[model samples]
Target: MVIYGVYIVSKSGGLIFNHDHNIPKVETEKVFSFPIDLTLEYDPKKVSVAFGQKDGINVGHILTSINGVAVNGNTTEEGNDVKELIENEGNYPLTLKFSRPKMTTNEKIFLASMFYPLFAIASQLSPEPKSSGIEVLEADTFKLHCFQTLTGVKFMTVAETTQTGMDVFLRKIYELYSDYVLKNPFYSLEMPIRCELFDANLQGLLEQIEKTGITNI
Candidate 1:
């Protein structure tokens, strides 16, 4: 049960907000593993590492293991331990494993933009009149769940195929959006959401969902 990302697409086909969850990938024998020696630039402020001009690793990759030590703690104290290990100066030849999202931000934005037209086509081609377009698109590995508000803003979640209760989760996302984004005085209509309050609340919500899954949230 893992959520890869959340995307908020505006009525006019603009990407307002995109959030990639830092979840460890489910280990499988079928999955390929490759070792790449690359220079890493760590941002203390973000507690994240970035590879200089590197391919493969993306921004939302979660630090799963470091030097054979599994850093899979969710609690504060456990997280502090992982932080300490990362900041320690003596640990050299860092062997790290990360769970990275499949798509990049640019790719996500492009997909979101393409969805509007796809939605329109779906509605037109529907057997029943007044169809609501594509709702849930299930694939071999992932599931895309979408809930469109009356105003045409679509809240979408990319999650594991077996995960459920995404409709409820998306509704909660709408409630949070209404509260933190729509209600913010500084927010411009249909613009990219930049509210700190919204980001904080959404991150908290994502963390909750990550820990407990959609049903628990």
Candidate 2:
């Protein structure tokens, strides 16, 4: 019934399929072609979606409400309402409502590539826009945690489950950038992070961290 462990609603609002991370197996066919940039954060509420894909949710789909509760103003309040509703609903299929605007290129590709936040793409993509904070997310296999700086640089890692000290870990990553990549005159200031030295150091750091046992991560 489900492909790719996820159901996608087509552009024409047609029934594609249904599945979630809890699903054990997903065929490869039911994949979303478009790279989605959803406005999970309520602040600076302008656009809801972005990027290119044919049979997928287009750019600029205005999310009006979640589970019949309108997202009027005060996103924190609306976010709470959504959370309570979902908890009470026992995690069933949610009736989401949104308005579609004419699709256009967002043209803001600051990052050359995204590291495929598996949880975001599979389950949902949104976060409370605050500061360089850490969030732990559930995924099909591993627990995914991320921290993003104000300047929009993101560092993420996969673990077996949620752990503390994640904020500190993310800060260490930023520190590595400050010490190696940014200071190097030859390194270009960009999103893709194409510095070989940075990559090597990051991997070495990860390996060192990995040996500390799962809970420490």
Candidate 3:
């Protein structure tokens, strides 16, 4: 559960920095649980919720506005407004509005098979990763668990199932990065990070996980 890879994205959608922690040098067996993917169509600007799950988020609705900003399907806002929203959202409750799509009986019956796992192209959408929790995707050879951020960064691990608290974990990483990396006067924007404090904190996270006996699957 402690495997981590973090990177920062730029406004133009570029990855200017990354920090890796405890990447596996050897392959291992993967485990997976039943996953319910609730996304239709892969536009980050437009999000949806899918129906039918045990512990579902019930995200089977169309995204309307976030933080009072209307998503008018306008490209003009991408550069200025969207960029600012992604980068400078400092510890605010993200308020989102959504509308559900009317579904046909046949569509509802067949929707279960349309689970959208992490596609290969998902990584290239942003220059940096986004703010997302960890989820498991059953691949051909293995089930991969990933921690994805909305800006285009993904922290992946090969495991049996996805775990919760990845967002909480990542926010902790960001807080430390903002303090030890961004707040550091010598740290240049988007440059490759070489911070000892960040590394030390990351290492501490690994130690904490091991000490608590957190199971991987």
Candidate 4:
């Protein structure tokens, strides 16, 4: 049987996360197997686990016993074990383990469903600007660039033309930047927004504008 633990770390090399499972939450009667193969299933994306052999021990061959009930994979079915068996009530453990190995069909489906919308949004967020004729203004307070698109629309940016720009005419850019870029939990002030989430939101807004049938100026 495989023994496993979950841990989260900062990009800066800080130990900011950890989790261990003691109980199962979801039902696995029809799904899962021994030697669980874990994969992340979430929007905004999340971390997943992969086990390795240790001391010649096959960690992938382990089984999970939740509340005296045995199930395979890294997830547990509801009622097989008491809720919060792994962590505690209201506290979600970041890591879990399973008996047996291999990714379950249900697990893969769940992961895909969880990430598909995010993936769609990301595809939309790619920077495919529709050429707007706006002029860039170089000034002390901020630098600006402008472009005019084929549609007779004007696009302008101030102070380094980030995903977010200063002031109106560029309000959408600023709003997109403020909410999706600046307000991101992981982003710092003045930092560029280049994550999957940012891209998704950006694409969504641009698509909305495109659909509105507004002529550009």
Clashes of each: 0, 1, 18, 42
lDDT per residue (tens digit) for residues 11-93 in model 4 = 22222222222222322222223323343222121112244433222433443444445433344544333223433443332
- Model 3 global lDDT (CA atoms, 0 to 1): 0.46
lDDT of each: 0.72, 0.44, 0.46, 0.36
Residues forming the 10-long window of minimal summed lDDT in candidate 2: 1-10
Evaluated at residue 126, the lDDT of candidate 3 is 41
**lDDT tens digits by residue: candidate 1, 82-112:** 5555446554435666555356678978989
Candidate 2 stretches with Cα past 4 Å from truth are: 1-134, 162-164, 213-217
Ten contiguous residues minimizing lDDT sum, candidate 1? 27-36
Error of 2 at 55 (Å): 30
Candidate 2 Cα deviation (angstroms), residue 141: 2.5
Ranking of candidates on TM-score, top first: 1, 3, 2, 4
lDDT of 3 by residue, 1-217 (tens): 4444444443333344454444443211112122313343335555454443223234555545555555543212333343334335462444544454444434522421222222334544545675233255565544545444454344334332343445455556566666787788986664656788878886676567656634331
Q: Tell me the deviation in Å of residue 122 in model 2.
A: 15
The TM-scores, one per candidate, come to 0.63, 0.36, 0.37, 0.23
What would the C-alpha RMSD of candidate 3 be, to one decimal place? 21.5
